[model samples]
Target: MVKLRLKRYGRKKLPSYRIIVIDSRNKRDGKAIEELGFYNPITNETRIDIPRVLQRLTEGAQATRTVQNILDRAQLIAKEEN
Candidate 1:
């Protein structure tokens, strides 16, 4: 199973995360099959590759709740395309 989850990184007290696609069994922060976006909580900033995200989703990737919210906010999948 493949899942889209966050990979934590950055300095202590100033964490950043990458929204990535990887094997479900892999440890968090370990190897990522593909990185679809980045989130910086401290800055309230996020960026994602929409096409890639959609592609991965279609390929059966499951996003974490936080990632889902982020994608929803981004309008990553425009309704017209669905």
Candidate 2:
């Protein structure tokens, strides 16, 4: 399975994250299929590749809960109209 998730980086106490697509079994900082965005919690800043993210999502990559919340807050996903 593939997962769209965060890869932690940066110095201690000042972490940054790269939103990446990777194999579910890979190590947290292992190789990634692609890097879709970046998040800096300290700055509350985010940069996303919307098209790539949507493509990965359509291709069955599951987003982590935090990523899901970010997507929701960014209004990146279309709501179901059932």
Candidate 3:
């Protein structure tokens, strides 16, 4: 199964992540099928490819809980903007 999840990067104790689409069988930081967004927890900043995220979701990509929350917030913000 394909899933949407965070892949850690950046320096220790100052982590950032890429929101990625990857196979379930792979490791946490394994190669991804596609990259959909970026998250920086320390700064509470997010940069998402909303359209591509919607496309992947429609195609049956399941997201992790944290990613789901992020997506929810992003979608809400997007709705407000439009």
Q: Each model's C-alpha lDDT? A: 0.91, 0.90, 0.96
Checking candidate 3 for backbone clashes, the offending pairs are: none
* Cα lDDT tens digits for candidate 3, 28-67: 9999999999999999999999899989999999999999
TM-score, every prediction: 0.89, 0.89, 0.94
Of 1 and 3, which scores higher on lDDT? 3
Task: Kindly report which residue pairs in candidate 2 clash with one another.
Answer: none
Model 1 lDDT tens row, 1-82: 9999999999999999999999999999889999989999999888899999999999999988988998897785456577
Q: Which predicted model would earn the best lDDT?
A: 3
By summed lDDT, which 10 consecutive residues of candidate 2 come out lowest? 73-82
**Whole-structure CA lDDT of model 2:** 0.90
- Cα lDDT for residue 82, candidate 3: 97
Better of 2 and 3 by TM-score: 3
Cα error, candidate 2, residue 1 (Å): 0.5
Candidate 2 Cα errors over 4 Å, as ranges: 76-82
- Please estimate how well model 1 matches the true structure, expressed as its whole-model Cα lDDT: 0.91
Error (Å) of candidate 3 at residue 24 is: 0.6
RMSD of 2: 4.1
| C-alpha lDDT (0 to 100) for residue 2 of candidate 1 | 93
